[model samples]
Target: MRFNIRITVSLKEGMLDPEARAIQGALKNLGFETTALSTSRLFHISLEALDREQAETLGLQMCERLLANPIIHRYSVEVLQ
Candidate 1:
């Protein structure tokens, strides 16, 4: 079976996101009011798997192995068939 997965990786709470902050600052300068902002990376992957559970597990393994840094990053995985 083939499965499609979406993985989102982001900095953990209390971690500073320079890009988000810079963008927010720019927005403020442009008269856009923003109280908070953050950034994340989204990855779309398609692979072969036996089931949804297996696909989700593979997605998480990808995150743990290379996509996200355990100490500073967190990730979410969704299996889209």
Candidate 2:
């Protein structure tokens, strides 16, 4: 069996602001400060797995363990066979 999987991840709302401020502060400490700001990003993945169930399980794992933070973010997946 062949399975298709897609994963999408992104930063949570307030997460980005604090991260950006932290980066800006660190840059200032390094004497390399800039007015430029930081924003969030998205992670996208597409892969094929040998078994439908396995693929789905692995995809879910990826989301649960690595992709989504769970602290302030949510994720979804699509499995096709």
RMSD of each predicted structure? 0.9, 5.6
Task: Give all TM-scores, in the order shown.
Answer: 0.94, 0.46
TM-score, candidate number 1: 0.94
Q: Residue 24 in model 1: shift from native, Å?
A: 0.5
The alpha-carbon deviation from the true structure for residue 18 of candidate 1, after best TM-score superposition, in angstroms, is 1.5
TM-score of 2: 0.46
Error in Å for residue 16 of model 2:
7.1
Candidate 1 local lDDT, 15-62, one digit each (tens): 988999999999999999999989999999999999999999999999
- Which is the leading candidate under lDDT? 1
